[model samples]
Target: MPLAGLFAGALGAAIAPFALRLRGPYLAIVSLGLVYIGIYAARNLPALTGGLNGTVVTAPVAIGPVDFAALQVGPFLLTREQGMFILCWGILALVLC
Candidate 1:
């Protein structure tokens, strides 16, 4: 799921058109209002945004033959947390480069 990147790109594109029509404090207030509205919706909409308590994730962590759920390499074995920690930082490093 390209969820994070997708939302970020879409938000940029969505705001760009409006940005041309807004300026200074007017734009700032509008942006702040939108953020407050978004937060309110997340809090009130139970099914949509998990009602602020948040949602449980049950996604598997895997990359080709490397399954993070039960990762083992020669003499090294890693737990789910350890595997995901490596994967996340590794991806961050790759993106930074």
Candidate 2:
């Protein structure tokens, strides 16, 4: 998600010059068109965005011996929601710090 945010920032920076060249309604139209363009690309590109079927994320979330997907701490087992809660808060804290 951080990488995606960075990529979006980089993309905005690169496009800023061209977008600035447009004034008033033209700029608004172009900004609105970007959404449609993204939808079109996602719908058309199966190999890229997985098209209508969508893609699955197979990555594992782990820290040392604890796999967050199947988290076990001593006799206690954590659920997926618990893992995500921990992950999200950890990321938020990291960003804040």
lDDT of 1 at 43: 83
* 19-92 per-residue lDDT for model 1 (tens digits): 76988998999888878988898888889666867656679999998898788867999888888888999899
RMSD, candidate 2, Å: 5.7
RMSD of each: 5.5, 5.7
Q: TM-scores of all models? A: 0.48, 0.51
Give one clash count per candidate, in the order shown: 0, 0
Q: Write the per-residue lDDT of candidate 2 for residues 32-96, one digit (tens) a residue.
A: 88888879988988797777885566777777776787776679888876887788798899999
- Minimal lDDT window, size 10, model 1: 48-57
Question: Could you give me the TM-score of model 1 versus the true structure?
Answer: 0.48
